[model samples]
Target: MPHDQLPTQAHAFLRQRHNELGIPGLARRWREVRAQIRANGTWRPTYDELAYAARVAWRNSGRCIGRLRWPSLIVRDRRHITTLHDVGRELAAHLDEATNGGRIRSVITVLAPATNAGPPPVRIISPQLARYAAWPSREGVLGDPANLALTRLATDLGWSGPTRRGPFDLLPWIAATADGVLHLLPTDPMHILEVPIQHPNHPWITDLGLRWPAVPVISNMTLTFGGLWFPAPFSGTFMASEIATRNLADEHRYHQLPAIITGLRLDDRDRLRTDKALLTLHEAVLYSFEAAGVSITDHHRESRAFARFAQHEEAADRVVVGDWSWLNSYPMTPQDPSWSRYYHPGQPTPALLRDPYCLALTAGHPKPGHEPSPRQRADVPPGRCRHTQPRKGGHVSTRTPVKAHRRLTRLAAAAVTLAAVTAGLVGVSGGPAQAAGCRAAPYSAKFGAADYFMQYDGVEVISYPKYPSYYRTTSQCRDIQVRNTGDGVDFGPFYACVNFYGRSGCNYWTYVPVGQWRNLATNVKDGTKFYVWVRIDMGKYYGFRAVGDW
Candidate 1:
């Protein structure tokens, strides 16, 4: 049946899509939506939720449906998979009856490690395939290729995330709808479901949410695993005007072709005749299909695509890493090291950890290719080494010559202690006590008051206990120290560091080893006397400020 004969709910859903596409005459239908939302006073399935979802789904799908108007193929949509039973059954028959039968293609994207890093997981499946894979479907729903792809992708990403989560979960990005967009809750033992969502009157929830909770990472949030919500706004806003102009182009004749395609390899002079997209981000998919005669319009902008107009063909499939542990393969420096000044430029991505955990060491254990870790001897004096011949202690002797560069690594680890303060306070005590000229003195009441850490010229004894000595360079930091004393609060895996090199990079900087966020602030004692550096969490920025008597 046509859109007019559909029920109010289906009609509302259709109108929303129309409004999003800037389809002519859509406003008349949207009036109905505005009235419905107003009458309800609040949305269980609110307009805000619906609109936002549709918007993002569009972007996620590479704006194929979001930007273009397919005038050729007939488009029919139903709110729930059950609503499209006839179409589902028809599509089902085609898949089964077709010769050289091949299962539909699909994939999943999941967040792993399993937490405390990066954004949430994402899973998507085409509409037709979703129905065949979900509950109450008539076919072999359990082993559908699309479902397997989704599961494989999740497994590859190290998701190990709880399964069968749903509609009211925290990660709206992965919530399930009756529609086929993307749903992967299996009724079998392949995956277990987990959720971070709560009911309004749930025993765990308070009226204000904050009143009953001080931490909300998993306890108070909602999570919808194995399901996805379709969104249209992200793509529309990112490509709105560009698409509008294309739709008006004389050649396309009112089709909302993607704007980024003009520079593509496909010729827009004839799309109906070509059956292709101008410049799809689907580079990996296009090339694979191309071998089978599936050509695309995205000839130029599909940088991800291997096949160019020049005839470059990509491998069969673009590999998405199946493991999350690899993300932790790099060293995360929580502070500066004795070998060099600071971390290499952008040593770590924000996907790593909190900024306070600056200059961190991921996996804590090194695999062959992994970067070495920063030392962890904070209380040790600057430019000094405590050499105790270990008869046989579990704590490895970092000073052993057999260890090669381990001593330098130790001092680098201590360098981190200079900036690991919980409060945004940095103390600077510029005297022989903190620096000892070319050496570091142990913690003392008098010297402790001046928190500034130190590095000197000639021979420099790094702060690590087993770290014997390190030479310095000209205009190199003659000596530096944390600007404060006694605020050595240990925050477990959370710490920050500074190199006193300047607000950002300077001549004395080193490869931050592994850490994210550029130093947002730096000071030179009096802003002119000597430069001071700082590392901090982005949420709580603590610029380099002199606290003690400089």
Candidate 2:
């Protein structure tokens, strides 16, 4: 590889660390990293600071400095972006005893309530707790604000199922099973939902100049909610409340809710922040957790941090058994000790940040939303790693690997040819020009249950001597296409959109477009470092392709 073919700083650090001591490397064994980088790469490697650094860099991307001065763009409600999260949270069972069967399933969840209260108003249970779950209201089950609203959420959203006779009474078959739980607790916080939900179809405006930007979730502190096992949505935009609500009432309600949950906040209109650490708001806090960037956990060593989260999660589940929905219901809300103890006015929720297993999807950690901060721009140079194809019969495969990419890229490329103009990307530009093509995973045979994982012909491109792990561009974009080359692969438009680091030589581009714009919902940019992701999903023996704005 030529000098120009070097990986981006971030990618380089990841690869180096992967090869050096391996991720989660022991302190002493990996302690020599600083010396390692000093002797080789451009800078010294930082430790115990990945999230901290990402937080710093992402926040400083010049995106957060102002009050979000972008045009108020609305993509309209699509199948994927328009989830009834608020309604789901409201309708979910906070306790396990009040349900028809009296139990919520024990599983991961994303909680996107209109506001926060004592604790998460919704409760998702695991199978163990599911057996002991309960509904929020039992007996005659009067249409209380919560149950009525929640049930409406199910019906109005057109969720597939039987009768929506109250979320607790999840009509037999509909209530049978769920991937996880959604919690909705309404607090009188100065929320924006009250504005939008109050008028979902009506056009509204925010202090951020966003007109009817229904889904502007805050990022950092926003993602922090998932640290406590909370799932929020997309961006950290503002939620509009009604005029009747009092600013004092909202603040009072904010204070009334669980400090732990309520404390999880986002950067509101008052962009007043503390640079000592990143200042974030609700959705942003949630998105921080939803962030994805190369899986931190590798095949080697052990995830000591993961073990701790598992233990805590288990203990919490045990204490939450029974029809305790009543225990923390309406007037009798109780505080959670764990969150209370760790509550700091402005501090990263390490507890949530460290544990990405249960909260990965909910928090959006290994997904979209999480972007790199500016500070992280200064990193060590990247290097080469060995690549191999899936081995057959205990030997590396002699067959050539198929090239794969997100479907939209190819579609967009075709469209570009038809349209005869490249809009956003400037073609693959950081390294020497190499013909566009796909390469096989070098270490496929090493996969234990290779069948379980999705395989693709990951394309390797060279541009101007830079080796971007993924594809990218500078133009705005005109067309993006994708191709499915597998048989009966359960893949949909899962891999379509991507995020790229803009280069004023400084900032990269990042967008959270809705699923309807393309097809897939899987984020191609989350785990990426420098290049924009041309996401693709190909099942066994099949390959995927992508071509967009190149």
Candidate 3:
């Protein structure tokens, strides 16, 4: 790679670390690295630096809620993997150690960076080593809808499936090597941990036949450090809701809720039914994982962890860039302190960046010439195939905004819980509810199911509605709010919006600061009323309007 291709500060970062950490190999490598930088302006990091970079990426992951454990990340140096088969072998070991027979550990295996300044020589097409197969059948599709395209890629790569396919069938690993040779490796059943879900309170849920892999090992992410890109596969234990709400109950996936709704005899017509089902389903995941002695974290526990992380970062004067929606996606999002505030997502630094091959496969595009495309890649499906096709594959499949909706519903439910709790609640013994003089209610209410709000004694909570994920859409329009004291006096439009759907909206207050005794309400006290106006618009796609008087 040319010297300019390397980040301008790459050498500086390495040199500073050399002087600070004083690691043995770094000084000698630093001399060689600088020589290469002078000759070609690009250099490779030593083994120790690679390990440091991997850990830094974990520490800087904004979308991940479990970042507090970044220090415990285990980085395995596998940069010498020269064969595609070896990639699979290492990945299997990754799964084995990551799962750790249910005592999961966060781990990453870093492969050699792209050499000769070319695209990655080896790439894993699968998002994770273990994912359910989405098989096409006369009756209907089986397994996770997310993996439909990759499933076809595996089959075409000479992978034979069981005669009787079930929803839990794991897909084989697919990779492309330096010589552009593609290899398919069947997933080892023993290396994968699939936990059957059973509700502690509702044992009948076991009959629903639900199970999910224990660890989420993400491959196909390019780990860039000191201006070099390493194909690193990393693993982390699943948040219970990631399995319950997304992999299982998502509309395009197992669509588990309809059955649960029927089993619980709840009315599906009402949107609240979905919320109830999600809560119960998530509960089952936590309970079952615990019963089976599998590692898992609930949303609340993770939120608390995030709070501590934020505080620690703040103490060090570090800016905590966060995707509010993602961080607040737990079943009880609104009640969490993290959701009540706003954050700036500065940048994705030292993080596990998405790979083109991974996105292509995710978009239903298989590797070119690796295997016959199940659906020819020529006819790209809008919305489904975000990237161009690698080879032939079936028609592009549509992914529902279920993942985004999952986050949205969580925030919405939290808002409802907040309102109920704020209105006043009795003690555990069922005494009469009591409240202080002040009352807080949701403001600028529109986008019914998407709107979220919370109010504590002195502070008010408001969340601008946002889209599901940036993967499917990019239009992030502004939301407006205004307040007035009856007459001509008014506070003009205050605007807020989120750039990416996967992120949270900017902050805006409909009312002004309260400390001034010459307040508008106090000044115009005689027979005067206060009014506030709020509007939300999404570029003519969706609009909401509301006005309130007090």
Q: Go through the candidates in order and give each one's C-alpha lDDT.
A: 0.23, 0.22, 0.55
User: What lDDT tens digits, residue by residue, belong to model 2 across residues 332-372?
Assistant: 11232111111111222211121111111111111121222
For candidate 1, write residues 1-550 as lDDT tens digits. Answer: 1223223443455454555555675565556544654564211233433333333222222112212221111111222222222322323332232211121111111111111122223211121121111111354332222222223322222223336632111111111222212222222211111112122222231121110100111111111111212111010111211222221121312221243243234565764422233222222223323333322223122212211211211132212111111111112122312212111112110011121111211001111221111122233333322101112321122223333223223223333221122222222233223333322233211211111221100111112111122211222223233333223232111122332211111123321212122221233333332222223322212112221222
Of the candidates numbered 1 and 2, which has the greater TM-score value?
1
For residues 100-169, could you state the per-residue lDDT of candidate 3 as single tens digits? 8889999999887785455566777677877888877887788876676566555544555677888888
Give each model's clash number.
68, 126, 8
Error of 3 at 470 (Å): 26
Worst 10 residues of 3 by lDDT: 468-477
TM-score of 3: 0.64
Model 2 ranges off by over 4 Å: 1-53, 56-179, 187-190, 193-215, 218-550
**Model 3: residues >4 Å from true position, as ranges?**
7-9, 15-30, 37-42, 268-271, 365-550
Model 3: lDDT to the true structure: 0.55
Best by TM-score: 3
User: What stretches of model 1 exceed 4 Å from their correct place?
Assistant: 1-31, 39-74, 80-293, 296-550
lDDT value, residue 74 of candidate 3: 89
